[model samples]
Target: MPIYTVNDQSIHVWEEGASDKQVALLIHGWSSSWFAMSPLFPILSRYRCLAVDLPGYGQSPKGDDPVSIVAYTDLLADLLRQVTDQPAVLIGHSMGGMISLTMSLRHPELIERMVLICPTISGRLSMFINMFLGPLVVLERVPFADRVTSLIETRIWRITDRVMKPASYAERSAISSEAHERIKADVRRPGQGQIRAECYRAMRENDLRGQLQKISHPSLYLWGMEDNTVPLRDASSVVAELPDADLRIIPNAGHWPHFEALVTTQRYVRAFLSTPIKLLKAQF
Candidate 1:
């Protein structure tokens, strides 16, 4: 376990695999912890993996400030510097994908490669959501906001466990009941509603579309073809913007391909990492 302070909060890190190989930073999506990325660690043991709790999740402490996507990216950049001198490969899911994209745009030199799983680049959220909830972003400064958010999150967790998560796995039958149970457990971390809500509030707060051309690192866009949660169409457009990128749609996977189609996703991940940077090209 490694702990680092950013914005007055402690971020906990979990390390796995051999340190001799290149570094791979594993970032979990919203309402998750370093443990959420555990499914990929054993398969991708070729590279040293650094997984983070991202404040308010796992054992990490929530800072006095509300969490935003930009804040996450900035903190990650500093954490990257403190962890290793070598450029690292970024592997992010959902909101983690947003942070990784921002990191690549703001600190390109620090990235060697990237793998995004159902990242929300654009066209995911509707204007109605932003219009209704955007003002709540400023309310993060209010002490009572966290209390209200936690109450709302309780209802969300109930619905998510009984409905959302089961629907996320396209090949639900392919995975064990235990796996789905683990996912349900992962999303219900304590006192994390404010971090979760603020992250959603932070989406589209930054414009990263046009700047995708600036990312020269070999990138992989591994998305679920049936991902209704983030939509494959939006991800495809983002992939088109990348200078050197590949897109692989898992036919039988939905939002959480890493868990639903572990073997197939693992194969794609290993093959992508094995390829030389210069030979990296777009593929479906």
Candidate 2:
């Protein structure tokens, strides 16, 4: 319920646990708010955990135009400066990962470490396809573009509903029924649609493959083998590019592995964070 006014935007933020020694910032993916990373709450709370609804999503107020991922990086940096004095570990999922990567490149001092979950780096061929066919895909934002994409997303969600059923059992088991309901309720916020549209637009225009080399922070890249959204094949390419990076794949998990494999994901994350880099390097 806490809100911080940053750069004329009202960002809804929440914190769990009270710790001056460590802090972790949770950044959600496209179409998701702070709740998307709720699966990590229990484990992350052991440290100082800060989850924020990016501008135009959840309780955060909407902006005039959908801002670019770089813009988000700037916003997050400013927010960090304003809120906590502690350097924070940035945990970003999907688009949030993109923001985190940008942050590392632009504001490495703000982060102690990074955890990227199914992060998007390159502007894949799919994005090109969307670029050429996008105008025809949607009709709202741009003539014939928004409508087309809206229709495509609607159908994609329909298919996702079917394909996602297998993982539902795990997702349901990971969180209580009540918590699941809360997640669904949060997704239904009025700003969600606009936020989704703006995000899609920003993604279409932003490509950061050229900038990955600039990031020097130690990073953990987590992937879900079953993720149809961002294929697992991209993981190796990302790892190869990052200077200090490690990879982990979650089995029987989709894009939302934190939800489907919450316990396993949290365990690995904590273990990774606790392990001394020198010791880990010695073992290798």
TM-score of 1: 0.85
Each model's total of backbone clashes: 0, 11
Backbone clash pairs for candidate 1 read: none
Taking all chains together, each candidate's TM-score versus the true structure is 0.85, 0.80
Q: In model 2, which runs have C-alpha deviations exceeding 4 angstroms?
A: 123-137, 140-188, 277-284
Local error of candidate 2 at 102, Å?
0.7
lDDT of 1 at 142: 48
lDDT of candidates 1 onward, in order: 0.73, 0.70
Distance (Å) between predicted and true CA of 185, model 2? 4.4
The sequence of per-residue lDDT tens digits that candidate 1 reaches over residues 147-241 is 77566876656645555543466744365678767766766666655665666666756556666777666788888866756766667567577
lDDT of predicted model 2? 0.70
Cα lDDT tens digits, model 2, 7-126, are 887889877877574778899877678988777877675577788898877778876654788888898899888867766789988888888988988888888788888887763423
